[model samples]
Target: MTLLDRLNQDMKQAMKNKDKETLSVIRMVKASIQNESIKLGKDTLSEDEDLTILSREVKQRKDSLQEFKNAGREDLVEKTENELDILAQYLPKQLSDEELTSIIQETIKEVNATSMKDMGKVMGSVMPKVKGQADGTKIKQIVEQKLR
Candidate 1:
């Protein structure tokens, strides 16, 4: 089933189960997807587009979690952490550190990126291959460490 279909199913289930937290996250995601579709003037989003939206949602939550922690807002931090967990359910399986490092090494070799100057080249090549599977910041850190 498509992402929208799965979201719809889960939304209904959440409503039936009276899961307010899950329901709220699902509604937010659905609205984001709908907004993207409307912005693009399409009736449906492609798999890549859906993944992009999911990744964006996950990234936003992660950033919020970090900020909340930094501000010592324990309550908001907990809520953001829960939101991240819920959003992760829709994303692809994440790449482990080993897997991500291996991919970065391969891309570095492919692009002949030997220095930080080639960071852009390495990142551009690696991001597409690992999209939605790895966090961009993690990938960048690995690339930087490997290049150094």
Candidate 2:
């Protein structure tokens, strides 16, 4: 089954189980996927495209969660945390720091990026390799640490 199919099945399950929070997040995800499809003038998105969208949704929720926590908005934090948890189910397994470090090292060598000026080249090469498996912010930090 495709990711969309799985999401549809889970959405139905959430509805049947009366899980309002899960249902809300799933519906939001579906809506975003549909919006992207509409933008591209297509009804179907590739697996990679779906993964990219899912990652974007999770990142957004994580950002909101952090903001809510910092502002002492416990109510919003809890709700965002729940949404993050629901979204996490669909994201690819995250990379370990060690694994990410190694990949960055290899990418630097492959791209021959020896200075900060080469940072963009390194990032461009690394992102495609780590897209779904790693967070871009974390990868940037690691690459910065390595390049310096």
Candidate 3:
């Protein structure tokens, strides 16, 4: 099913089950998707566009979660964690560390990146391959470690 359709179905279920958290998250995501479409003057978004929006939402939550943790805001941290969980359901399965490492290694070789100076080249080459499947921060860490 399309992401929007899935979201709509889940929204209905959440309402039936009185799941405020899920319902809220779904509504927010739907709004984000709709806003993106309107911004781009499109009536519908492609699958890649949907993934991009979902990825952006997940990244925003991750950043918030980290900030909340650093600030020792346990309540916000917990809420962000729950929101991340909800967002994750719409994203593709994340790459395991081993898989991500292997992909980075291959990309590094492909780009003939020999040092940290080529970090951007390696990242540019690898990001699209992993896209929504892996966190950019994690990818950067692995790329740095591999290059070093």
Each candidate's clash count: 0, 0, 0
TM-scores for the candidates = 0.99, 0.96, 0.97
Model 1: per-residue lDDT, tens digit, 43-137? 99999999999999999989989999999999999999999899989999999999999999999999999899999999999999999999999
Please provide, for model 2 over 74-123, each residue's C-alpha lDDT reduced to its tens digit, 9 standing for 90 to 100. Answer: 99999998888888888889899999999999999999999999999999
Task: Kindly report which residue stretches of model 2 are placed more than 4 angstroms away from their true locations once superposed.
Answer: none
Identify the candidate with maximal lDDT.
1
Whole-structure CA lDDT of model 1: 0.95
The full ranking of all candidates by lDDT, starting with the best, is: 1, 3, 2
RMSD of each: 0.6, 0.9, 0.9
Tens digits of per-residue lDDT, candidate 3, 1-148, equal: 8999999999999999999999999999999999999999999999899999999999999999999999999999999999999988888989999999999999998999999999999999999999899999999999999999
Best by TM-score: 1
**TM-score quality measure for candidate 3:** 0.97
Cα error, residue 101 of model 3, in Å, equals: 0.8
Task: Please report, in order, the local distance difference test score of every candidate based on alpha carbons.
Answer: 0.95, 0.92, 0.94
